[model samples]
Target: MNLIQGYDPDTLRELVDERECAERLAEIESQRSLPVLLERVWLLKVLDRLDEALELAEETVRQARMAGTRKDLLRARVLHATVLQNRGAHAAAAQELAHCANEAEGRGWFGIAAFAHQHHGRNAYEAHDFDVARESFKRSLFLRREAGADDTELEKALRAIDAAERRSAEAPGVLV
Candidate 1:
């Protein structure tokens, strides 16, 4: 299976075309490679099949640990954490993503680090911790710039920060 065509996480999230995801999932159903597993995890998550997503995410992590490279393992873990976040295990997701972001940054994988920080910010945003979300989003923006990400990515980070700031300002008992 060609893993490059339809598995971009950013595109998946931005478009959120359920039929497209379902078709892709069907196409990849028999593939058990790490990349395919990762794609499956994301597809399931986006399709709102959270239980299946979490299960496949856990399996993907295990497979990455056994056979994939460190970068692959980190990518698997990030997806696993995102599934956790989507499943409402906010604290667990935050902890996992914090480790991921730190590890990615330490290894100078700025693109991966930015992705982790961006999702970490999303987790905090969903939990209504707007301050943390804004801080994380800002960090993601910095990391994205460090990675020389494209304008689309940078704009997404900027938008996330703005959203967090707006939420913080509108929240009750928030000072600003």
Candidate 2:
């Protein structure tokens, strides 16, 4: 499986074999393509090598900005924001994701918008802002529908909403 397939997109948590990720990383170690770089960033992140992941993510963003398409740049930015979120730089991640989502939406890139919203939702969820998380997830779901996203994507968005709802209900004195 691909490095991305090894993680849950919304949560950025590993969902498959770590050895598989290692093998994939090894397989692509000699590559410098944007796609390869992106996969390396993801594999390093999932493997808990945050330092390497962050460094590679930044390089990937630079590469995407310099030589890749707008969609590629946005995707790189989103992944960079995710790494920031994972590193506990929640505010920075939120700002970057919001910008990415707005840009993607303005450009009619509904799929990317959905991805940004989903990750933004996860950031909010981690920060204990369940209402924001739920709203973001709802927006993601809507965007995914607009983009004709597959069932797996839609279901993930739905699950994120449900999780936010549950968390909101559990938190003391929080009204969602």
Candidate 3:
């Protein structure tokens, strides 16, 4: 697996034929090729084949751990947990991301911690547990801002959490 230099959707063409992309990347295993496969997985998620995307994401996380240093593990964990959350396995996803948060915190990866928080917030929101979402979203936004991804998904999560809170508060105990 190659290193991810950066995430530029435009340059990488966010959605592409996965098989072709994988083949192309396998042709030349550079320090920048693995991210292309990861990008394919992201595109797969966007296309709604979440199971396949989750599989690819898990593979990406595994390969990234093998190929990357501690510095890169931060990004790998974030991506993997994001895929899990996308699959709507909210509780499991949250637990996995919590592990990522702990690892990032131990490694002084504040940025990763922020993203993990945001993913955890997604998990909570999907589970219809607004209180946890509120707290997680708030932390995610704070950390993303500090990490320079001020306009990232973390911010979007904040918006979603706010909307969820409003809806939940108005419902008056619907009794799940």
Best by TM-score: 2
Could you estimate the TM-score for every candidate?
0.90, 0.93, 0.70
Per-residue CA lDDT of model 3 for 19-100, tens digit only, reads 6545654554343456665666655665567888788777777778888677566666677777777776777788888888
**Residue 5 CA displacement from its true place in model 1, Å:** 15
Tell me the tens digit of each residue's lDDT in model 1 across 1-176: 33233323322233466777789999889999888899999899888899999999999999999999988998999999999998999999999999999999999999999999999998898898999999999999999999999997898898888888888898999386
| Model 3 per-residue lDDT at 121 | 65
Off by over 4 Å in 1: 1-15, 174-176
Error of 1 at 135 (Å): 0.7
Candidate 2: the clashing residue pairs are none
Residue 125 shift from truth in candidate 3, angstroms? 0.5
Show where candidate 3 strays beyond 4 Å. 1-32, 148-158, 174-176
Going through the candidates in order, what is the number of backbone clashes in each? 0, 0, 0
Prediction 1 TM-score vs. true? 0.90
